[model samples]
Target: MSTTDDFDAEAWRAELEGYRDRKDEFFANERQSPIPADQRDAFDGLTYFDPDPAYRVEADVTPVESDETVVMETTVDTEQEYERVVELGFDVNGETATLVGYTGVGEDRDSLFVPFRDKTTGQQTYGAGRYMEFEVEGDVTEAETVTLDFNLAYHPFCAYNDAFACPLPPEENWLDVAVEAGERLPEV
Candidate 1:
């Protein structure tokens, strides 16, 4: 009998698999998803700010920005460090990708802001780039070796409708891999 606090990677994996199986239904029913009145008001008041100056990648790629960071909590066993807007660079299908994000802020102090897109846009994933949140180890000042996992990338609410104004991911955040995790767009 493992307690709730006991480590259970298999259970967590099973839960994620369930989400993947029902992603379509989850996204489709999101609009009708109910929330407490107070929570709804808070969600409504949330504003997403675009990155200023519009960071670019290649001549053909468009940049995206956002004010949200992926929230992750610190763990006792990891040597991870917290970082505020850590700078990271990678290559997506031979093209250069860059991302500047912060860590250690509000409630989820170990959170990370990773605004990114990939070559799969308009083909597999949402036409707009995806967002990912992760946990860091230490303070924001020491964020050089942060690990990024694409499996957590998710589409912004704006991707569902034009009525919402969402910031696009910067060109630098694009990933070359086909991230097969998280929510996918609802088929029209």
Candidate 2:
């Protein structure tokens, strides 16, 4: 965990709000939106917990040395393969926790994938889980730390429609703490 001494709470909040607005626009208007065609007429914006900087924390990134492969099960009957990349350790609301970060096998090397569930799962948020992904600067192996903005957490497309097969968060990445940030359960 790192101190937010240099964090600009106001700016961060503004940026997050903008992001949410753009996403809502896409979901409500885009033809490729995850919202079902029948529900598009009444489609509203996604629900989100208030943007709180407390949910945005700096995480220490510990790279995994082994070439470990994780077979993540999807919402459907299929599975996806990903390489275990790093362990992100951080503090959220005074609770210490760690989550595993992964990268799709043979996919973008710079993007880090972190699908996880919290106390909010199956209640205030998506029952399956939420996902957080960010681009790592330079090499992931050299990444010492990264920002984990839970305010950016979002539900997978499968949450809105069953046609999309989204990967379920592995048990290893489940957090005991209630991450009351980012998109909440859909109104539908």
* Whole-model lDDT per candidate: 0.48, 0.90
lDDT of 1 at 77: 25
Candidate 1: Cα lDDT at 131:
75
Q: Count the backbone clashes (under 3 Å) in each candidate.
A: 18, 0
Residue-level lDDT for 154 in candidate 1: 66
Candidate 1: which stretches are off by over 4 Å?
A: 1-12, 18-84, 89-98, 102-110, 135-138, 176-180, 186-188
Task: Tell me the tens digit of each residue's lDDT in model 1 across 27-111.
Answer: 4345542333334433332112221111211121122234454443221222323233556654433445556665444555556
Kindly give the stretch of ten consecutive residues in candidate 1 with the minimal lDDT sum. Answer: 51-60
Task: Report clash pairs, candidate 2.
Answer: none
lDDT of 1 at 57: 17
- Model 1's TM-score against the true structure: 0.49
TM-score of every prediction relative to native: 0.49, 0.95
